[model samples]
Target: MTCSPDDFRAAMRRFPSGVAIVAAGSAPHRAGMTATAICSLSADPPQVLACLNRLSSTCRAVEDARFFSINLLATSQLALARIFAGLEGGVSADQKFTAGVWRLGVTGAPILEDAVLTFECALVTAHPASTHNIVIGEVRHITGEVAEDALIYRSGVFGRWTGLAVTQPHLS
Candidate 1:
């Protein structure tokens, strides 16, 4: 039995994930894309993994620059996420940076100043996997404070994650 692409996507959408913008390159030659397929790969060496579409300009930029920044979004950054995702009308690739306050990281990758968290990384490796590349990086710098609310995506909708209260169960 084989699962269809649409079915696989639908199934995956059931799992909510944090939103992020993976950006590379410098101004006037930069590229970025909204992504949810980023996660911590290791802690001891401080590494992260981000999946980029093989055909995306961002992926090519990462390949050429050998550096990238993962800007984890806060709830207030929904507009920025939409812009990077190409969901905002009249905003072209060259104009995306205008929507957010950005700065150059140590690696020269563009970082969102107001992101919930920003990880500037040096590209370690990128492995081709089907339609995407599994890009790994060693974190070189980090910034931003812990936000009270974070942007999340689920079922094709953008949302926020607030602190959830957990109650301890009573035991005899």
Candidate 2:
């Protein structure tokens, strides 16, 4: 028998993940969503992947624009993340963007100016998965350097990374 949605969600909640905002489009058509399903896919050509729900407006915008941005959030930006995630006091989609300073990237997608790391990417391909689509983008441009601390989500709670207590002994 297949696992129920509640079972799957509870299991997934045990995994810690970084928070990000996936943005696409411009002006009146822009769309974004808070996501924790983003990850690096390759380093050779610089690629990244962001998984989005198939029925989300953000997903539709990304598919239509053929471009999108993955803006990694800083620990201080939890409120902004909540806005984008549609959880901040019921703010509407169009108004959610007002919470942050946004700038157009090379791909014409909105990039959060204060993001710890931002990747401007061109759509590569998308693979359908159950209730979501794995959207792959080739990193065409990037903004900001990695930050010391990042916003993390786990077990329905958000936290900040304070760096590792023990440093790595070796370097690549």
Judging by TM-score against the true structure, name the best candidate.
1
List the candidate 2 regions with Cα displacement exceeding 4 Å: 146-148
Looking at candidate 2, what is the lDDT of residue 50? 93
RMSD of 1: 2.7
Write model 2 residue lDDT over 1-172, tens digit each, in one string: 9999999999999899999999998888888999999999999999999999999989988999999999999989999888998887867655678888998987788899889999999999989999899999999998887565789999999998666788788878
lDDT of all the models against the reference? 0.92, 0.90
Global lDDT for candidate 2?
0.90
Stretches of model 1 off by over 4 angstroms after superposition: 169-172
Looking at model 2, report the run of 10 residues with the lowest lDDT sum: 88-97
